[model samples]
Target: MPISSKIARQMEEASWIRKMFEEGVRLAGQVGAGNIHDFTLGNPDLEPPPEFVESLRDLVVRPRAGMHRYMPNAGYPEVREAVARWVREESGVEVGGKHVILAVGAGGGLNVVLKALLDPGDEVVVFAPYFPEYAFYIDNHGGVLRVVETDGQFRIDFDRLEAAIGPRTKAVFVNSPNNPTGVVYDAAVLARLGGLLRDRSRKLGRAIYLVSDDPYKKILFDGTQYSHVFRHYESSIAVYSHSKDLGLAGERIGHVAVHPAANSAEALVAGMTFAIRVLGFVNAPGLMQLAIRDVLRACIDPSVYQRRRDVLHGALTELGFECVKPRGAFYLFPRSLEPDDRKFAKVCLGKNILIVPGVGFGRSGHFRISLTSSDRAIEASLPAWREVARAYATV
Candidate 1:
């Protein structure tokens, strides 16, 4: 049998990042690994904190009877309680175990939330230059994705966003320490967004939810503040992951925190639980849930990422590339030297350097560079970047 038309359409739209990675691998084999510089994916080369590994070891050897068994669909209550405590301390919001739903990861949490909220033909407002997967996730749940393009800096354009929210809009996806751009949304901007949503909700006589996709919440640098969206908006649901913060991307552990103060919080909680089951994640991994409870305070050293960010940002800037200084997250979105970002990416590939074209992230004339590589890789890639820059300068 043929694939469904919806899935077929998704498949036809290949990920530019993944495609670049494949090309990088092929080029690396041809030119030898020592010669090629690939920054195609944000897969961190850094190891997880020692505490995470230690927690995993302890969990493995423990005599706990239900270590591997599925707990409540919402997840192990103790884990949720621990996470809620952390949330309360961080966000100054009163939360409890009942407000949290453990999921496979941020990606899984997003899918679950979308399933819970989206009715056919419902509209989801997404800021452009977003993680491309968001479009796929919304479409998966029969929602229409309404993209709002930001200013050149990729900062929130309130006017454009305010105009996008209509009666059919069910949710808005906000990614801070955003992927592709790495620009953190300021608190004032978030407050404005909250006000806009509230006004629209009142006018429409219905609630419009804010879904914060915040895997990079804890990964900030240069003393940047990351806002807790729920504090700014009553109807916010946070989908967070330990992948970036704890350097446990492979662990696939994370949770969804539905704002306890949200309108219809109880109904939303029930819907999230049912969505978890229907999405086939019944519960987040049992062992990882217990492990995180023990090491809830553990996180990767921000300084390590900070140094890498500075090095990459400095290198690109030195080469005369224009880029928004990433306040957080380990990515640099440098404006392409030419109009055709795909062609510009091809030129970089010719120099044995791999960076994903920004067009993949719903923007053109820019490309994303992941700083999650080894320092050696960052240092080695400078010459190729210089060569690419020189070529552009001469054009």
Candidate 2:
């Protein structure tokens, strides 16, 4: 009764993933953690890559003078320059320090972008089966979320996407190697998307920015081709996190890079820096900003996740759970045996196999299993997964 109705509604509407994660903790306690396979959270269990570890250690052992003091709301100039160099190499854009704004994490960086772009009731389009928190982030800045469903392969259907864009449309969010499906958006796909947005923006007579949530850009597998979002769209913004690639989820380090080619690009960066300060993020942690500057070239080997993906995807597919083979990231989205994903998720819970239902990702009829768990957890979960599949077949 003390809480506002808006928050209550948000609680009811989303965070199924976090709810399931909490449930996993409780069940793990009750059943002994070994008895439960938690596939709820995408929190990685991998150690930070050795290069990242070394960089942090060196910086910590010999701190720079005033290293702990506040930095430019945009970030340490040198660190931003380093990140700019990394982005230039990856995105093929000649970005400079002025183009980047460091932030607490991808989540914080997203909020910064949304705050900078949205006016009240402005609409932001997102792909279906997106990260659930996107809806919340949109609302935090008084923007509306418009979801456009993807095709069976979880790739964009341009017609559907175009239909979703209209007056009041401010931006479109692209998340490649997507959170639940783990499918990478290829260069061809991005090029097509860029074309669609360009035509639509021309008709609407305004810039429809493309904001990419690219935390998993470095987690590619099977020689997955990486497409720079900036390469495809001039009005694009890239928000990246060290959470996935560096296994620094808890460290909460990330950056936002406005496409150097974007119109009013300098003003956009200035606005984002203002948002960072007022949003109370102030800036990304100083130590992390400095530490990662030297280790931009290294990330956790994709093979570390490729092995887990192979084990999990192969076993699930073998057991008759239809799934699109994931080429990147560490999640598998498989069709739920029943159309009611929440009901099916409950059934998995009965077997101590925890998964987030597809509804959590703005899609239904499927559930997500995160490979961020240990190899032992994946191996152990298989028999239980097999039992669930067998039971569902008869039903």
Candidate 3:
């Protein structure tokens, strides 16, 4: 009689992470904001670089005629060309404006690509402990999500992935420097993945697209670099955003770069462009597209995040928490001190600490900690974190 059953079920599934954050906010009011250790969201707290700000200001003050008007559904020609040039340099693949389609954000870009690709009942493979929204995205296009778990270190398990491949499999979604787990997929692993896709495609007599979600591509730590998937996988679609890297998450601007060498590249790009329009995005925010076009070279300093990661990871591990030191992105997945992560998270809440249970990201026996908050938040939260850990130690 009210919302559709489909939506009701999806909402129930997606509520856990948001519920934690909301509870954290409600508790903050009760205990005073500084007393709660909230690590439930990956919202980056850093401001955009000075250049990005200047570019925005410049664009606003010296407005071009019809600057706010809609350009092409694929995005402004100049913006697409700029993005294509950057992709070419980074991926070492020759792509031009025609291969790029701009969308509201990485999430929107993914939806657009999925809309263009998935027929009803098609299967999409995803690695577990992934961004939970992926299930919703795949479902939006009438595709089923077939999940395969990652290795102990959160790296891709090639054997398991190979086994997951089947005739219905149309795409494999990858998020390197993954959201819940921050492990970066190395070049060697990417090469292997590419080879597998090639062989599988030949055997099945079909093409399996590689969808690379890369919002955290530029936020890496320890001098690590992201493996450009397009170089290894020809039938790859790179969904990228300036949200995490430029601290423009609220602006919602990103693009999808189709591999120039992909099979029927022009057709794929056209389909993505049409999908973006039909899905109601029409185009990415004009101001943000222009804001990011020239400032493609800019990034919020990774060192700031690196220092935060070092402090949190080192302090937690020293206090007896098992954590995989993240190489990119702003979240850390730490093994729960107790057997049931939900109960362990509740124990944390008792200590005025809020964290997402690992099951929210398709894993259990652990929890996720978003390190994107202010350094003051991390430093202030440490004592409470230690108290929670100590409580678990005794249990």
Candidate 4:
């Protein structure tokens, strides 16, 4: 009764990840916290890399005049320049600061993008098994979400994608080294997607933007190659966050980069800058912006995550759980023991194991496990995982 009816309804359909996380908290009180195996959130247990930590220490120890002052809505010039160089290196696109706008993180950058691009009733097509928050983000901008299910291997079903696009379609969003399912989109797949968008844009008489959320681009595994959106499509935008790569989740810093050759690229950047102000993010945190700028090339040595993935994925499969090994990101999405994933998650909960049901990501009969747990936590959870697996095993 206190909140708006809209938000009230939204809260009812809130993220299962948070739901399970809260469940973890509630259950932690009963069992010693150490006995709880909470794979609910994608939050890494790792600390920020030494490079970023030292950079922050240096900046803090030697404060400059106006370092904490309000900056341009786009961001500090030097920070933007640093991000631009990183963009050029990773995406193979010749981008400059003019093409970039800093934001409160990939989440906020995405909201800024939708705020700038979406009109009332516009449609944004998303693939199934997606990050659940995308639905809320699209609704925030008065856009309709059209979910197209991926193929068995989590690859885009091109035919479904073609059918999903209509005259009012504004954009197609993708997250590589995806959230729940860690499938990485390769350049070949992107090439096919670019061709499709080009053909569809001409037929629809509008440019349908390919909006890529690449917060985990640098957190790849097993030498997996990441395809940058700008390199695959001309009418595209990229959102990058320092959270995953730098282990700076609480810093709340990231940037949006519009493809230099995109349709009305300059105007798109300007609109996003304005949206940044109107959305109240104004600019990314100034101290974080400056700190990340100095360590633009630094990352948390993704091998750490790769090892985590191998440990979890191997143990699951060996125990008869079916899952695709994650090529990147710190998650393992495995098919649930039964047809109902919620039931499976409840079973996991019985063992003091916390995982989000895959139905939350628009899929059923699966569940997500975050690989951000420490070796100790994983070791402790193995017995519980085995116990749960046996509970569902055929007698």
Candidate 5:
């Protein structure tokens, strides 16, 4: 049987991050895993909090029947209610159980929201240097992805964004403490984006929604504050994950919170629930849903990530790589010394180090280094990085 054209096209454009990880594995096999410095994937090296594991064990071993069975297409009411309470407490918004939908993860939540809202050929606007998956998610539902360039530092360019929105624009995606750049959009910038969307919606006589992908909501450092988009834009939905925050990436648990004050909030939520069913998630894993209800407020300590960040940032800068000191998250986007970022990545690989080229994330002349490795890996990788920089310096 022949594969569909759409699936074939998507396969041709698979994530470079995954590609780098595969290459690293191959290199490791060829030249002993201990010798290669692989920082390609953002898989956290930290263990999940002991309390979380304990809670999971307690839930799984309990004598209650039907604990493993599917409950609702959205989720168990109690779990959704607990999550809604957390959102209300954090954002001071009036959210109820009806407004929350449990998803497999932030990735699943995003796809569900896109499938629920996007009609064929509808447009979704995203800032440049975004998480590459945003394009794939939009295209999965036959929506056109419109990428708007940001300022030199990757801050939102309001003028360019305003020009991109038109009658067909369905949603705008905002990821703070962003994946590639790690640049968090401040309050003032969010306020301007709110005004732009409001005015554009009025002019076009259609409501455009804001989709906030917030897996890194709690992974901040250096007193950085991430503005809640729902506070700035009324037509906002928060698709959040417990992966980065709780170190539960493999568990696949997250939610979509449709702002209570959003226009047609009820309809939007209903559509999302339906999408969750049709997309075959059915519901979030039963055990994880129960486990997160008790630990929604808990997160992996920022100090560990902070220490890793400090060491990596200092070493890279001293080696003559210009990197935007990340305010949050466990990744650093460093400008490549050479104009060809892919070539720069190749150079690093030649030194038994692996990183992702920034061209995959809509920017060239840069590369991403994940700071989620062990301290030993970071310590061992620096001299090799310096060596690569020196080689490029001569060229």
Candidate 6:
């Protein structure tokens, strides 16, 4: 039987990260895993904090009645309450259980929010060099994605963004400590963005939701500052996950937080609850939700990633590669040796080094390197990288 046209199209546009990763695996078999330096995925190498493990142990041994059973579509009331208090303390938005919706993961939370807010043909604004999955998520909800290009430094280009907002625009999405580039947006810029959204909402006579995808909220380096969106934007929803900070990517534990000060918080929250159920994620995993509830403040130390970043950045720069110094996240967006990023990535692959092309992230003439691998792997890959750089220079 033929597959659906939509699935075929989506498969065609699937992640380059995974594609390269699979290639890396195939190459690993040929030349042992240690010989192939794979920087294709942001899969953290660090283990989850001791608190996370201890919590899981505590929950497992003291299994209460219905501990593994289904929960309300929104999640358990106690988990929601715990998340609410955490949000209140962190963001000072004064939310409660009514405003928190547990989700499968940050990606799942984003899908739930889109399902709740978007009408058919409505548009969701996203900055360029964004997470490619954003397009699929918006399309899944019958929403159109409007891509707005960012500045030279990958900061929001307000001029293009303001011009892009029109009557059909339903929401704007932002990912701080952004993927691909690892540029953490400044607080002033976020405030300005919130003001712009407010002004546009008034002019359009409707509320425009600011959707903040912040899975890397705590992965900062060297005094890099960060803040919650609820502190800046009124009509906002924060999608968070334990994937990056707690190294719980496979656990799929996360939540959607609707700002309490939003114009119609109650309705949005209700829509999110309904969306989670209808989207086939009746509720987030019961066990992990309970496990994460108590470890809200726990995170693996970021120093390991930071050291790796410094090592790779310094080594690559010395070899003549140009890249922005990443302030957060474990990825580096560096200019490809030549303008054709795909060709450059292929050239690196020939040397048993794997990296994703920037075209996958909506940009060309660049590539992304995820530094979530071991320091030994990075050190091992240096010779191959330097050889690629030298060969490009000669050509």
Cα shift from native, residue 196, model 1 (Å): 1.0
Instruction: Write model 2 residue lDDT over 134-235, tens digit each, in one string.
Output: 999999999999999999989998999878898999999999989989989999999999999888888888889999998888889888888989899999
Instruction: Show model 3 residue runs off by greater than 4 Å.
Output: none
Clashes of 4: 0
Each candidate's lDDT (Cα)?
A: 0.88, 0.90, 0.91, 0.90, 0.88, 0.91
lDDT of 3 by residue, 255-347 (tens): 999998887789999999999999998899999988888999799998898899999999999888888889998889999998799999899
Error of model 4, residue 60, in angstroms? 1.3
Runs off by more than 4 Å, candidate 6? 15-18
User: Which residue pairs in model 2 clash with each other?
Assistant: none
Clashes of each: 0, 0, 0, 0, 0, 0
Note the residue pairs that clash in candidate 3: none
Candidate 3 yields a Cα-based lDDT of 0.91
Worst 10 residues of 3 by lDDT: 386-395
Prediction 2 global C-alpha lDDT: 0.90
Candidate 1 regions off by >4 Å?
none
Question: Could you estimate the TM-score for every candidate?
Answer: 0.97, 0.97, 0.98, 0.98, 0.97, 0.97
Candidate 6, residues 1-395, lDDT tens digits: the string is: 39999988788788466678788889989998878888887887789999999999998898889888887999999999999999999888789998998999998999999999999999999998999999999999999999999877898999999999999999999999999898998789899999999999999998999999989889999899988889889999999999999999999999999998897999999999999999999999999999998998899898888999999999899888889899999899999999999999989999888999999888898999999888888898889988888888841
